[model samples]
Target: MKSKLTTTGSRLNPSQRPAICLGMPLYNQTRFLPQALDSLLAQTYGDFNLFVSDDSTEAGPGQIVNSYAAKDQRIVYHRNEYRRGLIDNWRNCFELAGEMDYFAWVGDHDAWHPRWLESMVQILNTCESVVLVYSQNVNIDNNGGILDKKIKPGISTLGMDNTRRPLVVCRQGQGFGNMVYGLVRARALRQAGVFPRVMWPDVILCIKLALIGDIHQVEEKLWFRRRTDRFSMPRQKRALFASYRPWYFKLPWPLVNAWMLTRSPPALAGSETGPQRNLRFNLAAVYFQRWWSKFGGGSWIGSPHEWRRGKATWIRKLKKFRTAVELKSK
Candidate 1:
């Protein structure tokens, strides 16, 4: 049976409305959901409403969210009747945000520093031209131990022309882990449209936003991304597409990307003749780079040598795990 969409918790008063909307779309993320919620509730900037859209099969996620919602009025919980797939669930979250001034998508397994929202909001409020603002990230393991800290890609496009922003995204938009979680202008997000139900839709969305306005990057590390040994690149791509359409995996990435490019915003397509040619050339280059990185000799695409090397790497990881276990036993 399709579950009826229902909301819990009281709505914010019109006079006390928040300045930003934080959308968290979750599925079977009970383990880290509490931490994620706590991080949001503890934000130094408290003028934001949180919308938690639970797509979990069981009732645990809803129960968890309600427990928090009971105490905090800023959180609004919505449970889907049936599984709405990843992309659709995300779209629903954005839709539920209504007309907030700014919007951000929070990951179920991620945590944000208290200063994150305050800092990002300052940038957007000060710079009228910037549509998005994000900070560096810290990667953590399943046990919440720090793994590494790194600056996210695509930060160099901070002040670039709108026409060149897409090219910068095409080249350096490695993973949407940090960028997608950034605070974005609500108006710009609506104008650019919610995520498309396709492979790496975040990349496409980022490109569209870049065409609309500038993107700012903060140097502070405020976002914490949880890294797990769950899915490889191929598996992630397959799962993302399988969730929406069965035949999506059968299509080549280049073809799919070409079709997506045609659907870019009118501002991008209506550029001058010089910029149009540059966009085409840069997009083609990005496609070629993606193909080379995925299927080239050094990659694991049907390469026995790479497979053997991967086995050796796994063996090293096993040894480390064993050593850690032995230490705990002692």
Candidate 2:
């Protein structure tokens, strides 16, 4: 499935090659698309290429992206023949990025302060051991009003052991999945594994990167995240799994956990020391707790048929949990 590029920006000279690639994977987000692009164009740090991969069904989104591409030679635009869903579109956008020192995924509905790129790039430049850099986020309502500020508190994993960093993410990280939008070293991102096509795959990628290097957080709120009520949590999960792994919803939660655990980066897999072992166990426990909260606890108390369903669910969960434990042990 090759994406046909619709428009290419002016080729950068060797000396003018971008320091970062801002990969924007967008769908039918015409309402907020212009704002997002404007924010990128306003970046204080301009040595970055903007690659907009449009998976929108309508022409509005493409038109907007093309309009931006026309004005800014740094903007490269590609519109897909059909909607490739979120994960595929994201992967395609990253792949479209030419060789660059850093890469950052930008959401269509999100906005950034003018200094966002500058602050992140500074960290990546000075800190060779850090693979990812992100700032605190501001949560905005759909209408573009600021709803909350300083949403994610800063936590610096700098100078931590590689194995210890991932555990910290698993336990204390406030914005685990949101780091997908952070500025990251291009080579480290490729090695950690380009966004996996799985539900909440960003979390897995974050863990993988933690196993390789430290993650630095900027205390300032430079990133803005728009919150929408269009898709509930479960609905989003169903759509994500359907698009990536159709069988994911049918399998027991433990099986899904086991599959994702096995997909951890090679760095994490190769280490079998005490800290690594503890990390695996703690992660598994967290997964089980989430699974039980969703499927096993309060939802079980109901009619006879519901009770029977609950019993079956528990049995399946236990069986799959044991299987995952055995696999991790080996």
The C-alpha stretches of model 2 lying farther than 4 A from their native spots are 1-18, 148-152, 241-246, 253-255, 264-330
Error of 2 at 34 (Å): 1.2
Q: What are the RMSDs of all candidates, in order?
A: 9.7, 12.2
Write the residue-wise lDDT of candidate 2 on 1-330 in tens digits. 011112124444557544789999887888888999999999998988999898887889999989889889999999877767777888888899968889999999899999999888776765667788887788889887888545555556765666566667755666665677899998888877788765567766786677667777777789888987643445665445324456575665444654565454665556567766666666656654444334422222423343556544456577699999999999
- Best TM-score goes to which candidate? 1
TM-score of predicted model 1?
0.77
Per-residue error at 226 for model 2, in Å?
1.7
Worst 10 residues of 1 by lDDT: 1-10
What are the clash counts of all predictions, listed in order? 1, 0
lDDT of each structure? 0.73, 0.73
